[model samples]
Target chain A: MMTARAAFAAVAFAALALPASAITVVVADGAPEIALRVGATGGTISQVSFAVAAATAGTGTLILGTTNAAAGSAQAPNFGTACAGNNVRIWARARSTAFSPRTATLTVNGSGNLTSGANTIPLTNFGWVTSGGTEIASGNFTGSPTQALLSFGTTREVSVCKRFQFLNTTIYPSGTYTGQVTYSLQMP
Target chain B: MNPTRLLASLALGAAILATAGPVHAEQPATDTTAPFAVNARLNFRLTYPRFLRFRVGATGATVNLMSFTVPAGNVGSGTPVAPTGGDAGGGTGVNVLVYGNNGQVTITATNSSGGLGIGTATASDGRINYNQISSVSSSGQLPAPVLTNAGGTTALPTLNSTLVTQRTAVWTYSYLNQTIPSAGTYGGTNASRGGRVTYTATMP
Candidate 1:
């Protein structure tokens, strides 16, 4: 009886050993997102700052969009007056995740427009800079929101800035101009 | 290999395995910046006041034609005089001065019978027997006159041009008290023979 019991116990031990033989890998899924805070509104004479944190792992795309559809480089609530200095800037920091250096694409929606009622300040007024620190592209917003604005092949900071310039001030009327913008970070 | 020791060892190993990494693999972790609202604002304003005026002479003063009596023997005769900024009646001519933009002055006979009738016209009540007599000049200002002697509704000349600035127009009047039956008072009241000429100025 004792001999029989020992054999049965050995069989049970083998079953448990099978699962323990494999290694366990601890991992964390994506976490809840943190908010990007832009402390103040933009204006004709001054520029504003906006910042976002780096991703934990993997490659992703960052998208920026606007509600108005005006066709110029200056974003909406347009410096309707065509004042001397107006603009926007965006920047990204170097990635801390060195092992999985994944490429990041920065894109802006063509629909990005700054609008006040029926009036709009265009998205083309904005420009982008890569981690190397030079303007890669400049001009008006395109016809689609899915348009690519910039690409990051390495883990580095990137930026975009806008400068609205108007040589003539005689055409604009006096009134309050106002509008809104949206952003997205996506991976596929 | 005691039974109790064997059972205890197995239980401990099971607990260790349970405390290890997740049994099911999870997707690679991702970090994102939440969506945010962007906004912007601007401010604007303008002012101008109201004005208009018209006079009948170089003195820039309004004038009323003075009353005058003609002898019965001169009933069929006509008279003409230059209006020198005064109420001197009997065919006195007057200079008209107007200052205003985009406005016109229209003169019409407002009498029930329309205007002075032609002495020989078949119908006697609606015609004015008169002529433009004289004007400053065609170059100074264009004159539009509908003055006639045939009996009918009479709307005198009208300055149809829109005035961009102040302007002056001058003209002489010739009055003929044609043989129209009774030689009663022939001026002043709108209903009387020659009656009054109503000048209306409008701007839009």
Candidate 2:
């Protein structure tokens, strides 16, 4: 009788093992989510002007002019009033949590021309000088027609500062000149 | 196939379902690629001056200083006085209207003859010698005038750092009253002796 009980116990263990195969093991995730934070948008670059009277003669590039009197002298606007800490701040991050590497790149596009009536000023006349804490390389828009602003091997956060610099000039038509620069961030 | 065999099969199926837990919790892997976008734009504008008008008196047609008594003497030397201000004279002040959207205007003065002249009696004699009569002090609306030189180039800040609206620059004249020329009406319509001092406007 004891021998018969041991054989029945073996049969029950085999039946449990058969059901184990029927149990499906499935792994899943909630959903793929990402986040990007860039400072204020819309006319991100401020309005700039030049005064011919105060402008000094320069051989290379044209810049905003300086003057003795406060009236109508050409000087760079205080960009900080509008931007974070007076400089452009760009930040981005992702939460794959899957340990998957993600990429984010920044690109700029525009005619690179500042216009007033028929007059035009090239975008190259001005530049972006990196300031304060920065993760990306320091360079100007003329060189960065399309370049990587930031990238990461995993989830990360970063911040940077950018200041706009104008070249000194002697000549350019007497008019209000304007130009545009576009920044695009892409992630996949 | 007896009742005991059927019961054993049913028990195995029940255990499998129980161990599986919530069926909805398990989800198959899906497409993981997603592209997101954000835009940054730049908009700037400038409104240049519509017309840069220089006028004398309270207002009137633009005119040059005319009809002055020639100092006596062949060498053009006399204790004669300087030319007086006009209705729109620098003494009274002239209005320079710079219509624009932003900032100041840079003004420069240049003479074609190198000096104020009537083809014969040159203000600089042969160079740029002319004084600007202005009421506003350097510390005021306009900077001190840098008188024109013999080379037709005047000192900068001719009207340096002027506001976008309208301001006055008065006018009067003093010439080296020496070596008076052959007496005749020095100027008339389209006379070459009527040297012109060109004023240019630009944003610095």
Candidate 3:
């Protein structure tokens, strides 16, 4: 007959053989584990408003906020430790037992154009630059459904901050234009 | 194999797996599938206020001067007199620019006096009505605002009423020379002598 210790050993071996399957993606403090989703509300939103006092005569100027702040003031997330005073932070991680060189990719896509009632501005007008940890370099929103932001190897964790900017090249209708974008992290 | 050794191996393996599982489960959600994916969203917003900018002659604080000299033989002979100075570099034309991000824009020309006064002469002493000055535009996109003794406003013909309005054109000025009068430099150094026409643009 099998002793108690042998039976326990069998169960322990079974547990060890189980596979690891979990990916973590967090914006600020909001948890996006299972499906890994983050959005423009609660702790995930990053917004800025531009108010121009005079119209430009020649080349267009950068969209500035109060005191001509280039990217506006940074906002603190509701839950996570805030990044630098000028950036929005993003955190992500992927864990698996499959292999040592698993690939993890991050992509961003906008919800069409920014709109204020009947007026609209192209999503491409928005761009960003990132820093700290694994960086995604700098790029503009392409308005594509799956524009790659960055990619990394398996069992990696990234905690980066991004600063957003607006290119005020063309004058659209005078109103508050708003939009949202989703940043997705996938691992295989 | 010895029972003690087998049990020890199983316990050790279980301990390692438990540690890894808790690490993954402690932070975010965990799945049992391959090619796992997650997403996070960010919102953006921009508020732009109504703005308008208009320029005529020159784009500075100092007003421009457009002088016209009628030859003795051409005076009152219905000969159109071109202007000198101003932004046109001795030519009769000056650049005009109008830009606004709201609805249609209206441009008006207003002068302090009803006509060009000659040496403190009263209206009965023969003055040149502002109507004698006419302007022709190089493009319809920014037609010249009409000049009159009573002052008038003209709404810009925008390509789209709901979109931004930005137009540029060259406005060439000419003296109609339609009537002869006892003149002594009808308008000169004095601002009240029709030497300046204030152009104002308004938008809603």
Candidate 4:
């Protein structure tokens, strides 16, 4: 009877053997992600102008410049897309166009996005910074060009198109005659 | 099976008992975790002026002054002022700094944050321009500023220690820049002017 009992336990253990080929499957949310390129491309100016540079004997003039130009591209809106997008906008401001005050009329032209209703927006960021302090550019993103009907006061860097232009003079004074205002726009 | 039956099945029961034994532990293994990272970062602030302003005194003034750091970091030997275009002037030698060089000195930047490592290494050279401006007239003022590269070049800084110290090393220098005053509304006399310098620090 005892032998029979032992034999029954052995049979039960053999019946409990599990399968070896089956694989357990699991499901869960993977990992987190981040984006590096978040902003749009194109015009990056709100205003543009010129300055005295200095009261030098031979006064000099400046030509509007663009950054990220398409390598060997030419003309006003020749700037290359460091990254691409259609949102281009720009603007120009002035201090005074008077030659003596070291000012000049600044004409701006660029590609990309522009004004919806009007083609131009004038600037008043001319003259010495302390003389007339103003915020030249802001909230710039994709398309639009700015023009300065006022004066290009001192020797300053103007945000023309999507780059900076350094206008200067020295015949008159050695101090920095900074004047200029330009803005840019692009997809944020 | 009964204990007696199991023992009878053993081939060398007496030998097994003589050669083998069972040992068990009462306690479980405790978790000992370690800290590790794939990458680290250094944290610090870059505080410097956008533009430096200097005064060209009535009489030519000379003191320790600075200049803008060039696009490549060429210690301004005598380059155009900032905003390199428009009216002001270039080659007028107004923003030139006559440096008293002392060779390239060693500079180090360290990050005490996560990495506890050196962030960047740089070299500082000592030199300043002492410019003498002769004219400030309208037609072509700044008569003629003579720049004599004065002061001996500085020597390289000692960097025997590692940059992990968590600080920055900057080589201090002195240079002179001059400006011939414009014919004033007051007197027919001419005065001298001075300049200022500024720089920014970056690390990787």
Candidate 5:
């Protein structure tokens, strides 16, 4: 009687292992956004800062964005803004039971903002980004935000909306973040 | 797992809201104002005056001398001669003296209108001296007549001019010799019987 019961308990254990061992992977899709988008009233956007990029969180490989890319430099950057190359970046991370969680920060610098033929503002980054130490490749943030107007013609405040895709660079995975971004005058 | 505590934070009592995306906060609203304005005016003033004078003419004038000498010795002679017509003493009653004759005589003559100064005379004593006499008269109607001492008491203004009228002289000489001088020198037997008379003229 005890041997029969042992076999039955083993069967119950295998059943529980069926679902748990199915090799599940929780994926954090692209969660990119345009926040604190700013510009002048009635004045055109002679330029814009493609400052923020997409973030991704998942149980598998997770990354902020391309490094040494034309959008962002390969290394850390200076926080101050200039009339030239912007210091814009994107970051993402991920975690799992068998792998370590990783985090990265990417940047996307562009030639301000200009309207495309689609009657929308498209970020014009010329595959050129500068940081504290290096230049990088081009097409780093392989996605773009949904074009929208960020202008206030006669009032003090304005509203804008944006979205983007996420991409991974390494095998790093599972990192989530709640944004605490600060917006300040770069070079008023 | 939460970033701070991993598995414990993941197990915390909280609900996980699901969606296809996360929303971000936008930039704060700001104000922008309009520009300024402008506008202006101008003005001026002025003043002035003129200058001028007054004037009149160079109209005309005249001068004169009327009859100032008359005849003595011969009345009606029209020459400056002695008054010898009525009572002889050559009618001047002077016996050739100028002021008084056998008595004092005063002679007065006027122009065509009877005035005071065409001629004058006063005789007395013996021979006619004919020194003191009167002036001439003048008028706005005619040119004054000028006379000259034409040898002795005969005064002719324009000594060659024709006579305009006959002269008349009053004589008191009749009292002297009571008539003509009983001498052969009375004109028809004259040796030189005329005497002098003086005359003067002046401007006002």
Candidate 6:
């Protein structure tokens, strides 16, 4: 017959060795939800403007005017303001109680080129530079359906500042050109 | 240990292994036990305003002066006489550029006075008609807008029908020595003497 101490040790060992149960208990409390927020008011859209000014000399290239003021959150590296004059604020968080090796990925995709009336500027003309977060590669839109932005380990949070720019090498028609992009966060 | 007590200890060990941290009961939570995705959207917009830039003779606010001198033997010869100093083209030709984002662009010339009057001189000295000053563009892309004493407007042909308007050319100015009048400087610094011809460009 096994002693009391031996029985207790066996019980503990069995408890640790048992496989994770398929049954999951879901609670109404909010604790470990992945979240992605942008701009000051997380739910609202972020708008930017690039007003072009006259070229310095006749027949000279046009210059891109001053961009709109920064509207990002007051996170570190750009506390209370953007790292650059035209940066947009971004916040991402992923909280999970899963075992080790948990990872979360973030990605972005655009609908299409920015359009104004019959004129359109290629989506590739828009690009971004980042600061104050896990450094994602800086690049221009590839006109593709989707592109990867960055990835991080789960149960972690990061804040990023993205400065957007328009390539002004070619002169375009006078009007407002608009477009949209969706950001997604996935965990496994 | 008693059998009941040992059974209770085993149950506690199993409970400890299965339980997670306390869950706050305030807000809704998402169960990430399985692979899942959450999405947030960002909308982008950009605004650009209309602009039109036109240059003739010289650039900037500096107005160029074109002066022509005809020899006494060549009076009324109807010969084209080039000026002395104005643009890079020895005062005869100057760079011209018309750039705008709108559709078609129209260029017009207007002078305050009816004709080039003899500076501070009476009508007896005679006035020179603006028609004496003529211009021809180097390229058909930007045809020379008519320059007349009464002023006129001309629409430039679009290079690309689907895109904005951008035209560049060299405009060569000449004085048609057609007639002889009372001796005097026909136009000078005096604004009333029609010394300046304002070139205005408009787009819709």
Query: TM for chain B in all models?
Result: 0.43, 0.44, 0.71, 0.16, 0.14, 0.71
Write one digit per residue (lDDT tens) for candidate 4, span A86-176.
1112222122123423322332222231121322112211111110112233222222244322233332212212333322211121122
Candidate 2 docking classification? incorrect
Candidate 5's residue-wise lDDT over B1-204, tens digit each?
Answer: 457686655645332433211222222111111111000000000000111100001112211111122324543333333233322232232111111101112222222211211121221222322222222222211112232223222222221112111112222211112122122222111213332222221111
Query: What tens-digit string does per-residue lDDT give for candidate 1 at B27-63?
Result: 1112443221112211100111122345443343343
* lDDT pick, better of 3 and 6: 6
Q: Write the per-residue lDDT of candidate 6 for residues A1-188, one digit (tens) a residue.
A: 56988999977875553322111112123345565655544334656555555552223333332233434645432133444556666556677665644567777775487788888877676777666444466577777766777777666655666777666655568778877766666677
Task: Name the candidate, 3 or 5, with the larger DockQ value.
Answer: 3
lDDT of 3 by residue, B85-144 (tens): 668635678888777877888787777665442323355556777777888888887877
**Model 1 scores what on Cα lDDT?**
0.34
Task: Give each model a TM-score.
Answer: 0.28, 0.38, 0.67, 0.14, 0.15, 0.59
Each prediction's Cα lDDT score? 0.34, 0.43, 0.62, 0.23, 0.22, 0.63
What is the Å distance of residue A182 in model 2 from its true position? 1.3
Model 6 earns a TM-score of 0.59
Superposed Cα deviation of residue A147, candidate 1 (Å):
56
Tens digits of per-residue lDDT for model 2, B1-204: 889999999999999987653211111111234764443443434333333443333445555443355545423554434444345443333344332323455556654544554554444344222432122332344332444434233222233223233344444444445444554544333435544555565543
Better TM-score candidate (1, 4): 1
Superposition error at A122 for model 5 (Å): 4.9
For candidate 4, the per-residue lDDT at B30 reads 11
- What's the CA error at residue B173 for candidate 5, in Å? 99
In angstroms, give how far residue A54 of model 6 lies from its true place: 8.8
lDDT of 4 by residue, B57-142 (tens): 21144422223223333333443334221122342213221111112222222212122111111112111223321123222211
lDDT of 3 by residue, A1-188 (tens): 56988999977875553322112232222222222323122332445454544555223666532211212222222123434445555555555444345666777875478899988888787776654434567668888988987776545455555666677766777788787776777766
- Of candidate 3 chain B, the 10-residue stretch with the lowest lDDT total is B21-30
Over A109-174, each residue of candidate 5 has an lDDT whose tens digit, in order, gives 232323322222222212223232221232332223322111111111111111111222211111
True contacts kept of each: 0.03, 0.36, 0.61, 0.00, 0.02, 0.56
- For candidate 4 chain B, the 10 contiguous residues with the lowest summed lDDT are B36-45
